[model samples]
Target: MCDQCISTVAASAGSRRRRLWDLPHQCHCPLVGVCFPLSTLRQLVNKALGGKAMADDYEVHVGAVSECLQRNRLSELLQKDLESRYASTVQAFRAAKTTKELAGLWADAVRRGDVAGAFWAALTHPRCDEVLQEVVLRDMHMLQHQAGAAIRVDIGKFNLLLREHGVLARELGKAQQRCTQLLAEKSAEIEQLNSQLVQQRAATIGKETRIAFLLQDLQQLRASLPDYENTSRLRKQLEQLAHRQAELETQNAQLRQQLGQAQRALSLRGPEDAPALASEPQQDPIKEAPITLHLGKKTVLCVGGRNGNLAHYREVIERAGGQFAHHDGGLENHQGALDAVLGAADLVICQTGCISHNAYWRVKDFCKRHGKQCVFVENPSTSSLSRSLQQIAQVP
Candidate 1:
């Protein structure tokens, strides 16, 4: 249509609610561009053209439809579709009772990016005027230019972000691989430490077992001496023998002189005196013998003594020809065995200083009940044990 024809149409419509075909030729481009997607506009134009093929160019299609100033098949369809699509915007515009209020609603719609519905609703609004149309057109023109510049900037930023993302992704993959390698190395080290710990524990247990066995063997060897108690006594006897040797030699000389005197007298007194001298017995100088204690094979039970002196205690009883038995007085040995050991013993010797009161009582009670001999020795020496045995031996 020509500008005069468009001017005449605008003059004919006098500010009543206008239709899409009644809008000025300039309003067509913004309304068509904002209100419809390209694909939708293409379909609508194709359908309106009665299957006539439209050009593929977007501008070609928009230009062809923009010249529809009078109502036709295409213009009528577009008007119906816009009114239907923006019914709520139209109702909101209708609520504005003045030209100023309607313009405010149009500005608000533009700010909210709802220009499609607002543009259709505002131009077709009953309060729409020439001045409001010119203002809205100018605003839409500036907005299109700003949108183009923003699009170009966004495309450049998006490309930069794409390259940065690739670099960051490669760094993240390398970091994860290094973390996995460190984890594997740490796991191997932990396994090695655990193996060494197991070996050290095994060696420690073996050493402990060997030490216990050796300690038991040592105790047995200490208790195995047959004559340990006689060592000191024998040393004293040897010293006494050395002192008596001089006395024995002097006596031998005096006895030989007496014998010579007796022989001279016997020769003077003749054969009768010889028979008397021959009948008398001669004395020896070294006549003493060593004394030893004998127990006559009795089972002597000694309870409680110093652990180091246990060998001496055993040797004392054994040297006296007595069978030796002992208990550690509920210290190292079990207390339960005290009663059984007490029952089997012929004589009970208790070392009170080294024994528990319970074991002492048990020994005392057993010996008292059975009427067996019991000796409570305060000292745990071998001499005390020897004296106890001698006291028992002299009991008749």
Candidate 2:
């Protein structure tokens, strides 16, 4: 029940009083004609009719009477009732600040059917808009106070941090001053040490210069001394040494030739002539071939070499039953030329020196991809070239 309900009840009561007085004579029989006052009638109706239907009927009757009543008077009565109810509600809400007490009041008002009590209950309850607004305002004020306290605490912390930083800066300045003083002291000491070092180095340099001059003087004195007798004696001794050196050289050459001949004879006998050759062969002059090799025709790819070496290699290849092709150009274009020649060649021989790693890698890759036999050869001397040609001719 609220102020509006109470006002409505009052209006209904007045209307019912008027209705009772104005009843028609035909319907005024003792059983049908009720003469109770408006208050008593409402009580009886409430007792007899319970639940939502009865409440709805009571509301509708009150609304009809209110609509029919004089507007000004009804409004005055409603305003007075609302004011009184509101004052009582404000006092109750103030008294019962906590949500639990407000909730208890709400249950009591609903049971007792008190309109003002119900309004106060709603005003004080937690879920109600009016109560929620007041609660939010209080919480906001509390938060603002807490924020002020936190700000103060933060300010204190910041001040402490600044003080510490100032102290640290002071300490660092003192340390820097100490370091600068020490550096000045060390610089003076270093200057003294540098002066001493310079003196020592100068003394050492003077001694070395004196020693050099003395050595030069000694050398000149030795050079200026009469040396014809010593030279004649030394020349005689040198002649004797020369004769011994020539004898030793001749013996070394004969030994080397003997070793080479032994190696060649052993190679010619294969592996089974060890026990039979108890006596050594007599020394003889080395025989020479009747004719030298000639390069008439052949095809060969000459990769990396000096110009003179390349010409000699071309000649040797022609002698060895192969034609000669040459690539002499920039490092960048060499791989392409080598690849073309390798693809057309019967055999690939890479001159190991003077070729770049990129060229070697490309040539090896080409040979591997084409399943061609690739040989790496050192540059041949004239005799080695002849031997290589003979070996090539013997290849099946």
Candidate 3:
């Protein structure tokens, strides 16, 4: 027995010693000389021998026995407590101080069928508790670090996306500005084109109006103009007729005056001279011709006489007591003829149709330069020739 066992036995023996004083047997041993009931003696021996041996050599032996008895008593008490307070005892074991103590409690709870106490004992061991706490803390820190890294990565990606969007927006703005500039340029071009079209249309309308006016004037001129040859010939014939009529009138007037003078002379003469004039029947007044008076001769020259009709036209001039001359040639020869006629003739007539435009112009220019009368004649037929002869006789 140990000190705990000895102390328990000694307490029981002391209570019983007061009830029984004398022993029934006596022993020769000095350590234990008295003997009584076997149960009582054994109790007394346990009390006296426990922890009383204080030798250094017996110290371990004594501690062993005391520990054995204490464990036996603890096992019995725990068995009874486990049925009622098993949960509380398990919780208390979780707060145990050492790995050994926790293991012992766990074994006791298992033998007594305390399931909760066994679980707590396993988890609350000193080494297991430290390792579990370290593992849990390490995992939590890893998770926090991973979460922070993920957040940083997301932020970086968001910034990149924002930068790209900004670039795109700038490009889009530039494109829009270019489009606006192009549209403005196109609008200006369109306006210029429209203005040009308006100017062109106005010019076309003005041209059309001028053409219409010219056409109307041309139509009026065509409606009024006689044939060129006929007009020229008629003008010439009228001039000739007027000249012949004037000559006839002058002759008639002279004749009338002469008759009156002769009658006066016959009356003034004596009776004998009157009888002599009566023998001639008064000079036969009806049959007598009037005296013709001579005047200074006038000459007219005709140029460009291709048909050689100038001789026939001379009859009209001779009746008027005037002379006529002509020069026949091409334009160059005609120009020389014009110069000669200008020097010799009082009047010059140039036929125009036989010449080109340049020759006609030259002839007209020559006449104007010399201050000569020039008559232009186109084609002449027999009727036109007769009319031209009449006009020449009647020329003023």
Candidate 4:
């Protein structure tokens, strides 16, 4: 028998909360291992030996278990640490009024996988008996053997998971590389599309400029044709219409003067004279004024036409009672000043054949953005402008 066995033999039976020294000799080894970690055992043994170090962990554990067999420095330290560590568990066990109840708590604690705290608490419980102590010790011994087998099984599972993690990490790296490659390809495709769009826009502008030149050349060629019978006939009809318009205007003026004289004469006469005037043949009411261009106060801006024809353009606008402004469509004037001119005018007449492509688009975009009335004329002629103004007048 060892010192712990001798102590167990000498120990008296008691029905009270026992200290570590009062526990069975067999209980000491398991209790020391279960209730305390190796590091703590080392510390307690170092403290008990007064700073004298042990050769190995086993020796330290042995020393702690041996000290726990009696009242000593290591045992006291362990008692204090366990109480502090398992304070809540100790308080819970204190609720047990009988040994059978305390044993039930220990069994429940074992099923719940908390034997460390429950073991210490139950063994040191006030109602704990020798039979209850032996049962707890037996349960703890079987639990240790079961725990060793579980640790080996867990190690195998852990190794399998670690291998799976490595495979997943490699696949994730490959996926990221593929995504980056696809992004680079998409960026290249977008760049190509943008380049194509810019080229197409330039080509479109070139074609428009060519078409304008062709139209202007065609107009010049038609003007040079002296034998064009249609032109001569139209000119003659225009002269005849002008002459007839002048005669009608003169006749309207004479009629208005005569009606004014008659109204004055009637006003001067009495009520009896009004009846004689009614019996006389009544003169026809004057005809309503002919539909004509009337711009009121709105300004008309003419952009890009023959410089010599600018006076003709102004004359037509002013005759229609509209304010007139003009820009040379970036030919001689600054292109930057066009925006300000466009902003101030209420209407715009764009001579497409007479202007640069840049000026044409600038004027068109400005008119579109400001919601200005813009008339695009292919022929930059006085007759065309007059007809455009006449059309504007006819709109409701």
Candidate 5:
């Protein structure tokens, strides 16, 4: 019975020694470490109160662990779970943004676990804190660099879009200018076409008027055909009168021959008689005609004539005792001066073929308003001018 008691005491002492050291059952030996888990402190203290030998050993081990935990500031942090504490430290360290927050990263590492592992890792290892800090900083810098590169790419794309807009605007402006130019050209073409159409209409109206007048004259001639018997009697009378006119012309020629022979005989008798006979003026047919016209010192505006025939016109007009001025319509000089010349002239003569429509209307209006004579001639010749003068003189 005493042998059994001694064996049981030995077994209890061994178990108590293992519990005081808090050795993991998985540990190969009892000499590996002296620290206990902070979670097991209350149970160890209760067991430590039961015996004097274990109390001294437990106090020494726990006192050492408490001192380490305090030094690393892991005393409060050790109350939580190991995984929870590690996750909290890692999150705080990563969430740190400024230099002040990064300065506390060492403390976070020390508190990453209970005092045993945390104090040993931070205080025991030579370069562990520095390696962790370097890793975090490198990752942050990489993120920043990637963000900057993306922003630069966005700016480049925006600039390219702006350049494209400028090119498109320039092209649009050029197209607008081209459109304006084309519109002006089209408007001018339309205006020109309208002018041509108006001129054609005027010509058509004039032709229709001429045709009406011709038709009227034809009807009048057809109505006069019933008097053909009177026309035959008149034809017989014309033949008899023609014979009488020939006989009278022969008698007048004989009388002229006899008178010339007598005048020559009388002139051969004396120089005094010859002087008296020469002093008498010969009779001009134009001056002696029944319907003679003499434009003495009258101003004539000869509008629209050939410049080549100007000298001949002046000479002819001067011989007829008249002043002459001329205009070339609008072919050469300004036609504005023609109005002043027409205003000063007594007679206005226009060549229908050579004169412009503007000049013809101006002369016609001036003559009608001022009660002056105006004549329209087909040809701008000296003979035509002289015939017009003769016709105007017979207006009385």
Candidate 6:
């Protein structure tokens, strides 16, 4: 029973010390015979209850408190020293130090129905401290539990606010990025519009230039309208003149054939009619040449003649049994080709009026050096060249 009492006292005292004061929580006392010191325990109880006040009715409970302490083998520790201050003789009773002894004293006070005595007894003695500490600890635990619940609720609310802010920030970032993309697309569209505008301006400039040129041409055509009528009349007159010239050339060809037939008929009369024809009044001989031209297959170079009519001069010389080649007055033929033709010819017929002064001298000089015969034609006509060739043929 004594060992049991000590174990119970130590357990309850440990609980009160942990709950109420700054006592050593890890008690090293052996459970079988441990007796806690009342001297030090009373000091701890006074310190713990220093903030509490005793009422005037404490005087009436002093006798009951003293009786309980005496029955429990407890005694007051500072009886002599406290006699002067406290009106109650509380210092006279032995103090209960251990939890078991305080419990027994409390039970006895309650059995005697001394409620005031139990209250004062629990505060003043160490052994009764476990009874009072249980009530205080229970009230403190209830307040702490309420505070923890309020703090947890505030933390949860703050977390919800943070998550809402994070979501808003993400949405704002997406909106800004979308705005940037739209701005870039608009910039590209504007650049394309600018390029098209430039091309349109260039096309407009080209069209304006073409329209100006067409307007100028229209003005020139209108100014020349009178000249168009005059040119048409001249063109008709030129065509009529060309038809008259063709008719004249046909008549001249017929006359030439008649002359050729008359000459042939006169020649057919032969030597029997030659003396009679000579005895009569002398008429111009029908043949221009009295005798045949005696050019023995020799080439004659005609230098510097009228360009288109050179064929007439060539035909005249060739009909008189001579070969003919002509230069276009040195304007159309090279000087070396003229020189070569002049060197190979047996005679040179130079139309001095048609040739340049230099060409006349060149032909004269070439004939003088090469011992070739040269004849000068002042007027380059077929009749003049025929007469010159006729006079030469009549030479002995």
TM-score of each: 0.53, 0.25, 0.23, 0.46, 0.31, 0.29
lDDT of every predicted structure (CA atoms) = 0.78, 0.53, 0.51, 0.82, 0.58, 0.58
lDDT of 2 by residue, 220-336 (tens): 887787564445544654565577667778989999999999888778894456556655676888863322334345355555555435545655676555787654322423344
Q: What is the alpha-carbon lDDT of model 1 when measured against the actual structure?
A: 0.78
Tens digits of per-residue lDDT, candidate 6, 16-39, equal: 322111111111111000112334
Which 10-residue span in candidate 4 carries the lowest summed lDDT?
Answer: 5-14
* Each prediction's number of clashing residue pairs: 0, 7, 9, 0, 0, 7
Summarize candidate 5's per-residue lDDT along 34-146 as a digit string, tens digits.
13443354443444444333345555444534433222323322223332434444344445443345445545543452333332222112222333434433433454466
- Candidate No. with top TM-score: 1
**What digit string (tens of lDDT, one per residue) describes model 1 on residues 1-396?**
667435634663355678777777888878888777777776777778778454775764565466456788778777777888889888888888788998999989988977878888887776777788888888888888888898889889988998999999999999999999999999999999999999999999999999999999888776685333334434553564455656677889999999999888767896776778789997778742222557688898888977556666777778778898777688766687678778888888999999999988888888888998899999988777777777776677
Q: What is the C-alpha local distance difference test score of candidate 6?
A: 0.58
Better of 4 and 5 by TM-score: 4
User: What tens-digit string does per-residue lDDT give for candidate 4 at 1-396?
Assistant: 566545443442444666788777688899888988888777877787789684698877777777777787778988888889899999899899887899899999999999999999988886776678779999999999999899889899989988998999999999999999999999999999999999999999999999999999988888898445444544654565577667778989999999999989878999998778789998899763343978886899999887657667877788788898887687766677788789989889999988889999999898888899999998998888887777777778
In candidate 4 the C-alpha lDDT for residue 291 amounts to 31
In model 5, where do residues sit more than 4 Å from their true spots?
1-291
Reference-based lDDT, residue 371, model 6: 90
Please provide, for model 3 over 1-396, each residue's C-alpha lDDT reduced to its tens digit, 9 standing for 90 to 100.
345433333343231220111111110111011112234333333454553433442342333223322334422332233324345654566565554565566556545654343442233233233333233234334544666899899999999999999999999999999999999999999999999999999999999999999999988886787454345544664565577767778989999999999989878989777667667744544542221422147776665544434445565446546677654434434344445555687766666666556656766777788797666667533234345545655565
Global fold similarity of model 1 (TM-score): 0.53
Q: After superposition, how far is residue 24 of candidate 6 from its true place, in Å?
A: 57
Cα lDDT for residue 212, model 3? Answer: 100
Model 3 ranges with Cα > 4 A deviation: 1-162, 228-304, 307-396
Kindly report which residue stretches of model 4 are placed more than 4 angstroms away from their true locations once superposed: 1-15, 47-54, 176-396
